[model samples]
Target: MVVTFDVSPEKEGSVLNYFYRQLTQTPAEVRGIDLGGKTAIVTGSNVGIGLECSRQLLDLGLSKLVLAVRNVSKGQAAATELSKDINLNPGTIEVWELDYASYDSICSFVERTKGLERLDIVILNAGIMATEARINPSTGHEETIQINYLSTALLAILLLPVVKSKRPLAEQPGRITITSSDTAAWAKLDERNEEPLLSSFDKPGKVDMLNRTFVSKLLGQLFLVELAKRVPSSVAVINMATPMMVYDSEINRETARSLMGKIVEVFRRRIGYTAAVGARMVVDAAVKHGEETHGQYLGLQKLKPMAPIVYSSEGDHLRSVLWRETLEEFSFAGVEDILNEVNSDRKEIL
Candidate 1:
């Protein structure tokens, strides 16, 4: 039984240490699996663990890499730096615009990647946290809910046709690895409060509504598990939960200059896991072949059971509801129609 907390350095330290030990010992051996013949798409790869994951995957020799970023310039800069480090071939890495906050961007990315020979890995790594008010983008969603969960769900559904197409039913399956957080266990999905999430500081007089981080995280996992079930045996969906606070490119350094921020930074340094360490779970999940680990939510590098809340019948029901509402909110009816076309095309070709 794992004890859950709000935001404690002590609890965070314990989780970070457990993962560091596990990651530090894994040697840099590229399993004979070559990604050159296949394709991989990673969101939010411009920085943080996403970038590290992309770099490591490239290190393993991928045929093609698509970095889905909102800012093409930043994406290009990051790609240049990474290429310089590992001698990146210009043909290997391609940058595409994908703002998870926008449904149109999701559709465009999906249409663009449909041209891949086979998508071996699709990583949903980009996420955001609202420190002030919960602002869902123009799409009218809680900003966190939209980008972190709904957008990813839409993208996954859009890409499912491609994932299910190139692979046979009884062989090594494709993979969908969603980057989740330990914070998800903090809150259970509340149907009554289906209101869009407010930015952290947007509340005029609201205090209790300020902290639903746990609820959001839990719901995110629930959504992934449901998607896994919906497309079972064809695609392996693994939720990578990092127990520790991670040190990533996204950490705001200027904010850390304040006395309070500096003090907080000290504790973060003492306990936060590095991007490389946090990335092992995703890499392991992505490369694990066969159907044995399909539809399982793994923590760190092992296939462990999800938090108890994720397994509850009530939780699953909420997940279904959220999924439906998310589609409606994101105006994703077109996704289903598009997948129908892809499947139809396959049938016609056969």
Candidate 2:
């Protein structure tokens, strides 16, 4: 399995700039903001950056906050813990179950969103860092790819309509932000030329464990490139906000027991930003700025392109390939019809 990053001039330069910002830039904080009437939902809110993002939203006076987790009981537990830190009005925060690993769970969560009266911001922060490749029993895709890319795409597609219709039509459009990473620039993506690209990702032997999350994040950026073309910023603003590399965020919980994880943790505490500080970027993406940032990458809270390769002719070909295969993968759920409806509803965007 491939374990090392593909070294190149592009990767070297990008990584260097990223590290410089990480070392020199001051951590971001969302201030002078108020969400008194807005409602927001965050996945993976039980711990790490998600939890702190939820906290910041509530502190800003978000009327309703939903912590969508895989386990309702644990989500409730998290909600309780959140309540103790700050005063929470009755029903201010709600716990909803959403498991990214299961297609049914994601679909059901979307269905539940129909009951909400308002949805101003959605931060899709739930993802895993895998140290090895494994297949999801419910969905046949590799675990990391399934959770971070495919299922995230499915949920984002389904939620776009809900966000569009329920938006309060404030000064700006509703936002759907995904937590992306700088590591995406390092993926080799040898599978780009495969006829059935997703299947190639499913082969455990074909994927390197270390690069799995990076591959998933890159796939997400590729999907977004195609998505923005079909669904315009007017319909709903969507973008990727990467915090670069955050330590003490516990996003790598999957590898917590491994020797590599321990070493990474030591350095993370020494060099990486705290989860609270890292989450400000996620909330910043959701609340600050407007249409200019739509369908773009917010690297360390700055507008940036996805990857050097995403602009190449080869990247263009791969984008079309990924779109076709991704839709086919979810055809059983009428995903194509869902996207077509989104496109048709936003015909004014054209």
Highest lDDT scorer: 2
Model 1 CA lDDT for position 315? 60
Best by TM-score: 2
User: By summed lDDT, which 10 consecutive residues of candidate 1 come out lowest?
Assistant: 195-204
Stretches off by above 4 angstroms in model 2 are 1-13, 169-171
- For model 1, how big is the CA root-mean-square deviation? 5.8
Model 1: residues with Cα > 4 Å off, grouped in runs: 1-33, 166-171, 188-210, 235-243, 249-262, 335-350
Candidate 1 lDDT score relative to the true structure:
0.64
Encode model 1's per-residue lDDT on 1-350: one tens digit a residue: 14233433334324454456455544243356666566788899998878877887887787778899999998998788778757655578889999998877888888888777667788888876544335554765566566676777778778877777755556466777777766555443444244433222223443332244445566677776665555545344434544236655463344465676678778777666677766766766777544555555555555555555665676666667766665555454565564455445336645
Candidate 2: tens digits of C-alpha lDDT, residues 40-155: 99999998889989999998989899999988998999899888867777999999999999999998999899999988899999998887788899988888999999999999
TM-score of each predicted structure versus truth: 0.79, 0.93
Each model's total of backbone clashes: 15, 0
For candidate 1, give the lDDT of residue 95. 90
